[model samples]
Target: MQQHINEKIEQFFRDYEKRFRDGLAGNVDTASITSAFADCFIEASPLGVHCGKNDAAFREAIPKGYDFYKGIGTTKMTIGHVTITALDDLHYMALVHWQSYYTKKDQTEVTIEFDVTYFLQHRNEELKIFAYITGDEQKVLQERGLVS
Candidate 1:
C-alpha cells in the first residue's frame, strides 16, 4: 500500500515537473500548470500570505511570471530533491527542491536553488496542490545581482 502510494505521488510530480518546465518556456497553455492546483489555494512566502484562485486574472498573471524569469535570462528550471510526507490518507506534504539556471549578461551561468513545501489533497484519486510555502526568492535574486 505504501509503495503504491509512493508510486502515485512520484508520477504526479513527474507530470507536474513537465508541465512546469513547458509552462515556463511558453510551450504550453497556462491551464496545463493551473490544472495541477486546487480551484483555490494558499501561497505563503517571505513576502506574505495570499489566497489564490484559478481564475481569469490568475491565468493572465502566469505569463508574466514566465516573462520575468525570461527577462532575467533564466535558461531552465530543474527539480532536485523531493521529500514527501503523508499527513493522512487524503492529505500530504511535499518538500520539493528546485534549481533555476540563468545566464547573465556577462555570459556566465548561475544556478539558484530553492525549496518549496506544498500541501496537497487527494480527491477522486488525484492529487492537487492546495497550498505552498516558499522562501524569499526575490531577495536572493537581488543579492545575487540577477535582478535590480
Candidate 2:
C-alpha cells in the first residue's frame, strides 16, 4: 500500500510539472494549469494570501503570471525535488523545490531555486491542490535584478 501510494503521488507531481512547464512555454492554456487546483484554493506568497475561485476572471489572471516570468526572460521551469507526505487517506502535502532558468539582457544565464509547499485533497477520485505556500520568489528575483 505504501509503495502504491508513493507511486500515485509521484505520478501526480510529474503530471503537475508537465502542465506548469507547458503553461510557462505558452504551449497550453491556463485551464491546463488551473485544472491542477480545486474550484476554490488559497494561495500564500510573499505578497499576501488570496482565496480564489476557478472563475473566468481567475482564468484570465493566470496568463499574467506567465507573462511576468517571460518578461523576466524565464526560459524554463523544472522540478528539482519533491517530498510527499500523506496526511491521510484523502489529504496529502507536497514540498516541492523548483528551478527556473532565466537569461539576463546581458546574456548571463541564471537559475533560481525555490520551494513551495502544497496541500492537496482527494476530491471526486482525484487530487487537487487546496492551498499552497510559496517562498519569497519575487524577492529573490529582485535581488538578482531579474525584476526591479
Candidate 3:
C-alpha cells in the first residue's frame, strides 16, 4: 500500500514536470493544467485569484502568468525543490519552490522566488489537483512597485 502511494507521488511529479516544461516553452496549450486540475477546482496564485470549476479559467491562467514574464523579456524558470507529503490514503500535499528570472522592460534583470502548495487527491482511479494556493504574492507586487 505504501509503495503504491509512493509510486503515485513519483508519477504525478514526473507527468506534471513534463507538462509544465512544455507549457513554459510554449510547446503546448494548457494540456497539463486543464487535465491535472479537476473541474470545480480553486486556484490562488501570485498573479490573481481564479476560483471554481471553470476549465477556461485554468486554460487561461498559465498564459496570463507568462505574459508578465514575456513582457519582462527572456524569462527563465527553475524548479528549486518539490516535497510531497501524504495527508491520508487518498490525499497528498505537494510543496513546490521555484524561481523566475527575467529582464525588466528597463533592461534590468531580476529574479524572484515563489512557493506554491498544491492539494492532490485520488478520485475515480486518477490523481487530480483540486486546490492550489500561492505564497508571497504581496512581495511580488512590491517587487514590481505595484503596491506599497
Candidate 4:
C-alpha cells in the first residue's frame, strides 16, 4: 500500500512537471498549472521562506522578479530519477534530478541540471509539495573542475 501511494505521488510530480513545462512554453493555460498545485503548499528554498503558511501566503511570497502566474519559459524538463522515502501514510521525502532548458523571449537558450529535494504531504488524497530545495549542479561541477 505504501509503495502504491509512493508511485501515485511520483506520477503526480511527473504530471505536474509536464504541466509546468507546457505553461512555461505558453502552450497550456496557466490556470491549469496553478490548479494542479492549489491544494498543496510550496515552500521553495532561497526564497518563499514563509510561503507554506497558507495558499494566500504562498501566492504573496512569490520570489522577487518572478511571476508565478506568468510562468517560466522552460523548453524542457528531463527528470532523470525520483526516489521517494515514505515517512508515514501522509508524508514522504523525494530526491529528484533533472535537466532543464529555458528559452528567453529573444530565443536564447540556457541549460541547467539540478538536483532537488522535496518534502511532500497528502491532503485530501492529493499530493502537495510542502518544502523543496534546488541544488545547482553547475556550481558543483565547476567546483570539482568537471566543467570549465
Residue clash pairs of candidate 3: 40-53
- Candidate 1's displacement at residue 64, Å, is 1.4
Candidate 3 local distance difference test against the native: 0.71
Model 4 gets an lDDT of 0.64
Error of 2 at 22 (Å): 1.7
In model 4, the clashing pairs are none
Structural RMSD, model 2: 1.5
Model 1's TM-score against the true structure: 0.94
RMSD of each: 1.2, 1.5, 3.4, 5.7
- Candidate scoring better on TM-score of 2 and 4: 2
In angstroms, what RMSD does candidate 4 have relative to the true structure? Answer: 5.7
lDDT of 1 by residue, 1-148 (tens): 7677777877778787777678667776787778888999999998999999988988999888888888898888878877889999899898988888999989889999999899989889878999999999889999878999
Tell me the TM-score of model 4: 0.65
All candidates in order of lDDT, best leading: 1, 2, 3, 4
Least well predicted 10-residue stretch by lDDT in candidate 2: 1-10
Estimate, for each residue in 1-70, the C-alpha lDDT of model 4 and write its tens digit. 8878878877977886776566555566444445545355555655434444445554444332133323
Local distance difference test, each candidate: 0.86, 0.84, 0.71, 0.64
After the best TM-score superposition of candidate 1, give how far the Cα of residue 74 lies from its true spot, in angstroms: 0.9
lDDT of 3 at 13: 67
